[model samples]
Target: MDPDDGEGLFSDAFPTRELPPASAFPGQDPHALGGARDNILEVAIGREVRSFRNKLGITVADLAAATGLSLGMLSKIENGVTSPSLTTLQTLSRALGVPVTAFFRRFEERREAVFVKAGEGLLIERRGTRAGHQYRLLGHNAGNTGRVVVEPYVITLTEESDVFPLFQHSGLEFIYMLEGEVIYRHADKLYHLTPGDSLFFDADAPHGPDEMRQLPIRFLSIISYAKDEV
Candidate 1:
């Protein structure tokens, strides 16, 4: 309005809007913990960063000074108040003497569960399946993941099934006889497995049913191994 008073003629038309508060982000509320579960990355990253910092015996001020960041910014990062950029994370990683991936190690560690309805297990085939053996996978979807791999199958062998004894694989195997009877083999060992009987052994050695002692044999075949294994 006052063009002659060192002010632009359109100054009043383009008024500066007040800036938002430092603690306020677009969608996140720093005070609300209800939405925390949905923001797992924030919580996990904060926990990891704080834990690493504590282990190194350093204060927020020390980290801020080392990373060339302000104390408020570091506090926000540690408190999960803000989602940090990759550049910021790289800076923190360098100052902490740890890899950037170390911050995510605790993120993927979660409570895992798999539930399958009765008779809803996926029908899968194996070496013995062609010989009339039936294999129903109970929890194959969630299996073979994480630090350990687990596969659970409900195996049924009828009278029409042939006696095959040449199953070999990695990891360890466990068999729990649920119905009928069978003479199981593990390498050179022969075990007469009956109802309520259980067998646990290394899977490295060749193993399978040496003989079906009774018809309609049903058992649980569970195999597990380390994730790092070849």
Candidate 2:
């Protein structure tokens, strides 16, 4: 199927929202949210890249040559010290002989529904404990049907950094701020969200949260992706 065809699928599956202008967050630079430091998503990508490279008996230099990236840059990416851009991830995907989706966690089985009482969901440590980002998986598909899968999670953020690593995938993402405030960055724009405010957009766009305020800002994130894409 043509790659562009998926855009229609996304539109049909999820309702679109008009995004506010980047100036919505006046005087805020989206680039200021991230730097040489790593976030959970970057760490996960780094680990996956290293694992795939090692499994193929490939060296950093070899990967650098294949991906046309500098050895130093690749090293920083692999060490979770820096995050790669969409173009960089695509290049690495080609070099590793895998789809870009391979960098994300995989969920196989499908389930009709799942329930998690307050404070009872599985606590995931993707960003590491020191990062002060808490992610709890609420539910996901557990069946074998190769249809679109929906996974929901509750995220608690305590990081005070102005910048953060961004991530993208082949899917749609919906975020609803539950408590406190946060600056949600999508591509080149930033949206300030408060309790009850929600944002929905294409997941393939590089996006993340920055400038989290209030000791612990909590939100609900729902990720929808085609099962076959995994």
Candidate 3:
């Protein structure tokens, strides 16, 4: 084996094929999305993929063969040159013998109990550039075969106006006000909630904070979704 022939090693070990351009994927335009070109999520996914492959002593060629993806496409994905779609991610996860969520964050083995200390949760931005909203993922059900999908988060709202668009998802949501006050809007109705107040509603119905009073307000939000839905 020639030490200088990196691509040749893979070609000799497995069959090679040409991959379509990034734009070929549905709704993906490599030249159009500037911010997504090197976004944090893409970078994180690439890093994890590369790390996992290396840990398994598998070369890029091996991964390409296992995933039925072109070597060039795999290279681009591992290098964060492009973001993989959900289908592509699922393929990779299957090839790697891990769940799709593994690309997002590390997964721990199932434990009978878990603990999260105050101010120690992982902050996540699920809503994209939404301002005045801080979300800290308190915890998630771990293990690959965990049936229930429960995600508890600490949400802080500082926006005084209700200009933000309502958001909805498929699941049940419960919110318990912890500090300050806010007008919570669900569907077409609004309810004022203060400390010790709680609201349970269908997450499918559009809901958001109608108003944030007493400056910054903190609350606990627990969302439950079917395991398959996750």
Candidate number achieving the greatest lDDT relative to the actual structure: 1
Structural similarity to truth (TM-score) of each candidate: 0.56, 0.49, 0.49
The model with the greatest TM-score is 1
Alpha-carbon lDDT, every model: 0.81, 0.74, 0.76
Off by over 4 Å in 2: 1-111, 127-130, 144-146, 159-165
**TM-score of structure candidate 2:** 0.49
lDDT of 1 at 187: 67
Cα-based lDDT at residue 159, candidate 1: 86
Give a tens-digit lDDT track for model 3, residues 53-151.
888899999999999999999998887778899999999999888888888762232235568998989988776226657889887874546667889
Kindly report which residue pairs in candidate 3 clash with one another. Answer: none
RMSD of each: 26.7, 20.7, 23.1
How well is each residue in 117-224 modelled by candidate 1, as lDDT tens digits? 987788987878899999999885244346877889999999889988788888999999999988886665567789998888889888898888788999999988
- Model 2 lDDT per residue over 161-190, tens place: 334537677799899989988777676556
Candidate order, lDDT descending: 1, 3, 2
Q: Which stretches of candidate 1 lie over 4 Å from their true place?
A: 1-95, 99-105, 108-112, 141-147, 226-230
